[model samples]
Target chain A: MLLALLRRFGQMIFVMFGISVLVFLIFFVTPGADPAARIAGRNASPETLEAVRKSFGFDQPVWVQYLTMMKKLFVTQDLTSFVNRGWKVVPAVLDTIPVTLSLVIGAAILWVVFGMLVGLIAAATRGSWIDKLLMALGLVGCAMPVYWLGEMMNLVSQSRYHDTWLFSWVPPLGYKNLSDDPRGWFLTLVIPWFTLAILYIGLYGRVLRANLIEAMQEDYIRTARAKGLSETRILLRHALRTSLISFVTLFGLDFGALVGGAALLTEVVFGLQGVGKLTYDALQNLDLPVIMTTVIYASFFVVLANALVDVVYILIDPRVRSA
Target chain B: MLEVRDLRISFRTEHGRVQAIDGVSFDVGESEILGVVGESGSGKTISLLAVMGLINDPNARIEGSIKLRGRELVGLEPREMRKLRGREIAMIFQDPMTAMTPVYTIGWQIAEQIMAHEKIGKAAALARAVDLLAEVNIPNPREAIHRFPHQLSGGMRQRAVIAMALSCNPALLIADEPTTALDVTVQAQILDLIRKLRRDHKSAVVFITHDMGVIAEMADRVMVMYSGRIVERGTKAEILLEPRHPYTRALLDSIPPLEGEKPKRLRSIPGSPPSLFDLPKGCSFAPRCPSRFERCAERPALEGGKHAAACFLKVAS
Candidate 1:
């Protein structure tokens, strides 16, 4: 097991390295793009353009440039955003981590608990009115786009009924640091978490329900029944336990992506300055340093998530242990 | 003792109601082995599964009474049925490879059955699990208990399943073709283990199988089923040596002879059993019975003494 983990860790490092190189190459390969021109700002003096080029190493080999950028970003810790003169790229990215982490973690818990409950209820009461009702709700949740849902939520809570008792308790938009005031932090992030979680809850619930129904039909379930286990026990222990294998795999990928700035729609609508918002702004302004940092940061989470999934997979499934 | 009377099971489908088990009736006494032999779809497994209250299809309709130790089992709530299962009556199946939850250790699975009905602690239940393994003749029982189902061989897994069924010392043990998936040598060993377990536990055994050899080796009483109904039933010697129904005779004849002159070819019943959806109006076996006559126009009900045959010919003579 330790060896498997070590192997996965090794693979994660290589994957992150490959992603960084790929992102770097793609940034420079775009047609007629000039990092030096962009960094120097509009109508700059010729000498300023030369200085920017030399400072950013646009004149050096791509590998040497990559290495220098890595050194400035990690070793020297002084990499700054080219577009925003005094803004440090790493600190700005690091600052957004807490907000993004708070959003992703809260939404992940909400979706996992909500989705698994919906799936289990649907599977257990299959062919009943409750099953139909839950599945219909899940379908509606899935059909609505996250951005549209977020805006509609904002419209209702922030404007249309801002003074209503239901909406009064909802705090103003934007994130509050947890260490500053935990209650405010929770209240501030609650709506965004649900808005982000709705789509995944629908998707995951439907998938989990289908897998669980299939697992319930397995011969082992029959054996469980013969063992005189209660319906709840049989469903929880024998069926859902097996069904969660695929569910966990899906969760790992979704959680990783969300933490890596895929919650841009929710973050934007809620006015929370998360990594997703930072990435969005960097892309619009063509801030190469900030963009590179964000890309590498996102890839790191994704690789780590995959490694965590592999480890959890072995723990749950005995068949994988010997392999 | 267990008694099933007028037990009927049907499934509702788009095509119509399919009668899976039609008016089946039988009884088993304590410490006795009743062998039920039939081909696929004969409702052998279905009947036993129904008795265990394990068949939970929404479209299924089960009628009549199943009495264990004179307590009515039909119409019992799921909660009540669950209490009876694994405690009063336990089951083992044909494919041991898939019979157990793959994620659990064999000891944990065995202890689960014991812990389900008994008020035993985890440690005592686990220790008993090891003992059950040893009782089933699994080598290194202590070590084997910690292993998963897939880690064991086919024979070993079946033994583990048997040990689980015997964990609670159920009053009745239902073996649903338990040896069918095993090798011939392994099959004999499993049969021996069951016979020994039955003797030691003093539990009634309902052993379902398709092999007549298995029935002859393990059964005290035998029942021959065809198309969801018992065509013939009697003591093992009476059924094997003097089968009364044409279907029973045909089944016995199909077995290759072991002595004298070898036949040029083995005898096989000419026609296959009818589909449950569109069974013949009369005797279900009439289509395939060589001795079928005009009198077979009406369905024959099982009748007569302890040794009985559902036939117009009265082959009992």
Candidate 2:
């Protein structure tokens, strides 16, 4: 077990390194907008541009700049944003991290539990009216875009019924720090959480329902039932564990992708300043340093999520460990 | 000991109600190996499943009495039936590859059965699992316990399944073509294992297969089924040497000789078993039975001493 963990840790480091390099090359080496111009803004004079270029080491060789950036981001931890005019990006990221984390984490919990419940019910009653209805709901959830759904929700709750009991308690159009006011934080994110969760709940519940139904047909499940296991035990203990293999695979990749700023649409529509929003703004302003940092940050989550999935795979499946 | 009498099962399909098992009856005596030989869709597997109360199709209607040690099994609640399955009766399926859950280790899978029926802790159950694996002659039981079903070879997997079925020392073991998926050598090994298990545990076994050689090798008595009904049933010697039913004779004659001068023309059953939906009005197998008579338009009843056959010829004799 110790050896396996150590091996996984080593793989994680290698993946992180690869991702960091890719992010650096894509943002820095790729021919596109000038980092100097982006940092200096449109109105900077020649002297200011030269000063800004030299100060951030843009005048240095590409390899040297890459190494310097890596050192500042990892070794020294003194990275600052050229686009933000010398402001430290880490503290800014730290400020928004908790809110995004809360949103994703809460949505994930709701999606998994409620999705599985719906899926189990649908599968158990396979050909019944309830199954058909749940499946129809799943299709709607999968077909509707998250951004569109968020917009629709905002219009209905914020615009159409702002004075009504249903819409009166919606967040006041901004994120609140949990430390400053936990209630405000919850109220602010609750709508966004539900909005984000809607699409996933549908997709995941259908996938889970199909997988569980398939698992129930497996000979092992029949054996389990034959062994006198109750329907509940057979469903949860025997069938669910096996079906979760695919679910976990999808979850791992998705969690990483979401953390990597794939949730930008939802963040933008809801006015949440998540890493996704930060990355989008950085890209728009051609801010290389901020963009690179966000890329690295998102890459870290992706790589870390994959590593966690590997560990989870070994735990859930003995075949993997044995091999 | 288990007794099945006049068991009939039908399924509601798009065409109409298809009779899958028609008036099938057989008794598995204590410590006797009863071989059920038939091709696919012969209702052999479905018969055992009905006995276990695992049939879940909403359209399926089952009528019969399955008595195990005097208790009627047909009308019992699912919960009660479940309790009876692994405790008093157990089953090992045909495809060993899919017979056990893929995610859990063989030890965990076996231990699950033990824990389900008995109030045993993990440690004790695991220890018992290793012991059972060793009894089944798996090499390095300790190491093999942690390995998943996929890691094992076909033969090893079948052994693991058998070990699991025998975990609770069930009175009856229903092996639904257990060795069908295995190669010849593995098939022989598995058959040997089942024979040894029967002797060691003194458990009655209902071994389902299409191989006459397998039936000759393991069965004390044999039942030959075609189109969801028993065509012939007798002692292994009687069925192999003197098959009363033409379908049984055709099946025995169809086996290719392993080492001898080959026949110029291997005998083959003339036609396929009739589709369950459009079954012949009278005899189900009349189309395939070479000795079918004019009176075969009426269904024949099972007759003849302890060894019975559902045939007009046998009934007339």
Top TM-score prediction, candidate number:
1
Q: What is candidate 2's CA lDDT for residue A135? A: 91
TM-score (C-alpha, index-matched) for candidate 2: 0.87
Question: Candidate 1 — which pairs collide?
Answer: none
Q: What C-alpha lDDT values do all the predictions have?
A: 0.91, 0.86
Candidate closest to the true structure, highest lDDT: 1
lDDT value, residue A28 of candidate 2: 68
Candidate 1 wrongly placed segments (more than 4 Å): A37-52, B261-264, B315-317
lDDT tens digits, residues B1-317, model 2? 79999999999998889899999999999999999998888899999999888898899999999999999999898778888888789999989988888877899989988998899999999999999999998999999999888999989999999999999999999999998899999899889999999999989999999999999999999999888899889999999998888888889989988889999988888878788888898788888877878999998888887777778886566
Q: Pick out the ten consecutive residues of candidate 1 chain A with the lowest summed lDDT.
A: A26-35
- Residues B199-225 of candidate 1: C-alpha lDDT, one tens digit per residue: 899999999999999998999999999
Backbone clash total for model 2 is 0
The TM-scores that each candidate's chain B achieves against the reference are 0.98, 0.97
Can you tell me the DockQ of model 1? Answer: 0.79
Question: Model 2 clash pairs?
Answer: none
User: Which stretches of model 2 miss by more than 4 angstroms?
Assistant: A1-84, A88-90, A148-171, B119-131, B138-147, B183-189, B257-266, B313-317
